[model samples]
Target: MRAVLNKIRPKEKEEVASDLKDVFDNFSEDDTINKAKEKLEKFIAKWSDKYLKLSNCFNEVIVEYYFTYIKFSCNIRRMIYTTNSIENLNKKIRKATKNKQSFEKSSRLLDFLFVIIKDFELANTDEISSTCFLFLGGLRHNYRHGPLQEQQS
Candidate 1:
């Protein structure tokens, strides 16, 4: 997929110009450009009322139409928005479980998180604190000793 996109992208500008030239040349009836412009204007005017009516009709029925057809539409944004939050949460949980595969019980997981919250509370005690210290402390808490260290100590 990526290779195909890159392959086509190299020729995009030339391809677009070629398509535009074809479209422009297709409407020409005479050697004069003004005749082409005149024909384009007449053609646009002939369809303008139908276009306007369709636009208004869609606006009036949008809610009903959307409910009827939105499920069939493949909207990336809607799919991402609905799934990303839960996906991110699952990713965090997966990382947590990967780091500590020995957590055989839910209570142990809760206990580990409780210790982390407590450690952060303790680390935030002093008024003169550095962000680096907090970040390092949190990293160590999550990845290094964890609650097991405190239990052993």
Candidate 2:
């Protein structure tokens, strides 16, 4: 996928990426799979002729299972849908392992990776803890006891 994306000129790449984002954003807004499908069809109709390969790739590979994320809670949906953290982790792992030629055993490689990941977790613990506290506080005060809910009631 990255290779295919890289093949596009920079300006066209941005446009294509934005168009793809719109498709996912539409799916995210839908409350039901039927609505999502409808939105997806409309998106496909708009883009399919212009970007046949991308439309075909999504229809063939993604349309089958992407809607399942809608069933999860907002936090879970965010975690599942966004790849930034996972991609960052992958980049770190690649950098850490790039110098090494080989490991005697897969277990040894995993052990090394575990230590690296543990160190990273420790390094970020403070930031993560503060974010968690802020997230919980927001949930309590904003959603549970905010003015919007009062007005709705």
What are the Cα lDDT values of the candidates?
0.40, 0.57
lDDT of 1: 0.40
Off by over 4 Å in 1: 1-81, 112-153
Please name the candidate that would achieve the greatest TM-score relative to the true structure. 2
> In model 2, what is the error at residue 24, expressed in angstroms?
0.8
Candidate 2, poorest ten consecutive residues by summed lDDT? 141-150
Predicted structure 2, TM vs. truth: 0.48
Global fold similarity of model 1 (TM-score): 0.22
Could you tell me which residue pairs clash in candidate 1?
none
Every model's TM-score? 0.22, 0.48
lDDT of 1 by residue, 1-153 (tens): 122223334545455345333323422223233443454345335434534332232232442432332233232223322444435444554665577867766547765654544444454444212232333334334434445433442
How accurate locally is residue 145 in candidate 1, as Cα lDDT from 0 to 100? Answer: 44
